[model samples]
Target chain A: MEVEKKQQCSELLQLVIDGQATQQQRHELDEHLPKCECCRNEFELSLSIKEGLKSRLKKPNLPSELATSIQSKVLELA
Target chain B: MSVGESMPYKSKDKQRVFNKEFMPHIDAMYNFAYRLTLDEDDAKDLVQETYLKAFRFINSFEEGTNAKAWLFRILKNSFINNYRKVSKQPNKVDYQEVESYYNSESVDEKITTDLRVETVQHMIGDEITNALNSLDIDFRTVIILCDLEGFTYEEMAKILDIPIGTVRSRLHRARNLLKEKLVNYATSMGYKDKRK
Candidate 1:
């Protein structure tokens, strides 16, 4: 597996999504993404996949009985 | 054990708060527990115990802190202090035994057809899941956290109590492993071989 030289924009794109981008980095990527085709597509794809996953995650409902029992146990320990 | 009593606390008013707030979180906790314990029954027991401990220590939950993260903190502590009985975790699978590096590499006389590409693409999701399940827990958890759960590298570091560099490197390894698995599954499914 050859390691491709990671573009500054790719790094920035990841940082921005993770909310770890600094002001300068964010500004730079914001400017770069429109001009950089690969970075733009990558960012769009990741964002779409993220949203799709969250939407598709089935309603995380436990059984009502499980809830009742766990709740009692929670309060008991409290 | 409540028998036919209609479950005494089932009617308690604060019970609504518990149901609405804490219960839905069990699945996530179960998933995380499975990763740590690697046994369904043990994971289930750990989850139940974690919930019990959470209930006992619910008052210590500071209101403003993210409740889910707090709950995870409690659960992680429980695994570490109470249930990670061994001094160290078991030996992991030697990735070398599984790594088909020659196949992973681009080479002559191999793999360049449209039908194969389509088949490979189609099985990506399930293959990725199997690959993830195969990796050592640490690598798999980082991938699940960063890629699947969309946690920031820093957040993953905090959750796993590792450094950010470890998170990034592990994420890279995990993703590559998934890609390899997808390719192998497609090939071994004999989709590519039969057409040739």
Candidate 2:
């Protein structure tokens, strides 16, 4: 791909991955991805990364007492 | 009296809003604070401060508007105002420097990370968490907001006080930086990139 074309594809790829792509843009990317190995790889990798972050990252336990404490404090202020 | 100006709320209504709208997002708020501060005690203080401020200014928050985003905006601002200077994270990189560097000539260069999708899928929670935590705070923030918290670009733009264009670009840069870190971790663990 030419430099300009690649940059445009990259941007469109991001839009699609982020779920911000317009329907037309999504169609355009779908048409282009099958023809471009680089973009297909990028799209897949980016999606996988998002998936990993959502599912694999550990959520810390919110301190059990913190909410109660904040509630009491808010009660005081109110 | 700009938009989002505080409206008059009865004390009863304020309590209602605080319990119904704000309290539900406490877990998310705590997670965001922990990610930003990367410390337990600080996260606790930051979240408490945010909630108190939220209650004090509850009138400004319209009832049906996005409470999560509004709360996030407050927590983010509080983090900047109070905690950033005393951040335990050493050698914080300036956001301006990172932004300029990412926007320059190398912006288009695809960061080569030697991690396959399979490897990324196989990564444990701690590996992914460590990779995320390793990023500069600004870059780390976009990922947390978009990926973990599921904020839209518009909401993110509002929360971070940046333009929509900046939000898009920053998220792009942040994801690539994260990918690089994940791939580096994969390589260190002897995972191979089948594509390469």
Candidate 3:
């Protein structure tokens, strides 16, 4: 059963990212990552890359004056 | 002429009416305007113009409709009518050409896979802005809607006034193209060097 499970396992790092890996798949991945140094490197690399991309996409600052002006303008109608 | 055809001519008299009705929508309108114009000043003016138009046609608005959706419709029409300028650059990437390369069975069927957000995130980020800027107008809009704004497939079709199938196909192709670009970027950027 374990050998069958191992053969069916996909890349743990990717399945984790895609949100498609099942519980069994995760268990297999956890087991593999400790013995597999290469996968460990992949996990760290993926984390750094994800963080950098997310950081670059910060929401544009809505200037306070602009917000106030827009708010006052909108509220006047009510 | 239709009843709506003669309404816009009356905006001059309805300026105050428009201001009262749409004043509160300025910020959201500005955001949508920016999404369309990609320029802050242009977006502001677009919102202003939309407010004026909505005011003129306020008589046509239903008593209990989605005001935001109506406003966005007006903003979209304004962009289409006003800024349909032609650009001469060709920036196209067709993903169907490379679909043959992916082995469906090889994509690792492991349950709970280990794809980390951090792994491909930066790889995609470096070249994404450039790649997005290069897509044709239609593709760029869809890519931004789904990938950036996270709009659902149905919502996109309604916003673009297109079929759902077109949205799905375009999204699928756009993602693949993005993935291809990011993979290449990762390989070139010391990712592969450390592996070596």
Better of 1 and 3 by DockQ: 1
lDDT of 2 by residue, B138-167 (tens): 889989999999988889999999898888
Q: In candidate 2, list every pair of residues with a backbone clash.
A: none
Just chain B of model 1: what TM-score? 0.63
Q: What shift in Å separates residue A30 of candidate 1 from its native position after superposition?
A: 6.9
**If the candidates were sorted by their lDDT against the true structure, best first, what order would they fall in?**
2, 1, 3
Greater DockQ among 1 and 2 belongs to 2
lDDT of 1 by residue, B1-196 (tens): 1113332232353345445555667878776777666666666667788877655554455433455665666677777776566625646534454333322323211222212334543443445456556666656666556655566776676666767865554554454454455457666766554545
Could you arrange the candidates by TM-score from highest to lowest? Answer: 2, 1, 3
- In order, what is each prediction's RMSD in angstroms? 9.0, 2.3, 9.0
Residue B120 of candidate 1: its Cα lDDT? Answer: 40
Compared with the true structure, what per-residue lDDT tens digits does model 3 show for residues B1-196?
0124333324343445445555566655675566556666776667766766665567666433445556666777787767545324343334454243222322222211333334355344435455455455566666665545445666667767768756655654444444454555555664543322
In Å, candidate 1's interface RMSD is: 7.2
DockQ scores of all models, one per candidate = 0.21, 0.68, 0.10
Better of 1 and 2 by lDDT: 2
- Point to the candidate with the largest lDDT: 2
Please state the i-RMS of candidate 3: 8.2
Task: Provide the clashing-pair count of each candidate structure.
Answer: 5, 0, 24
- The list of candidate 3 runs beyond 4 A from truth reads A1-58, A61-78, B1-28, B86-117, B123-128, B184-189, B193-196
The window of 10 residues in a row where model 2 chain B has the poorest summed lDDT is B105-114
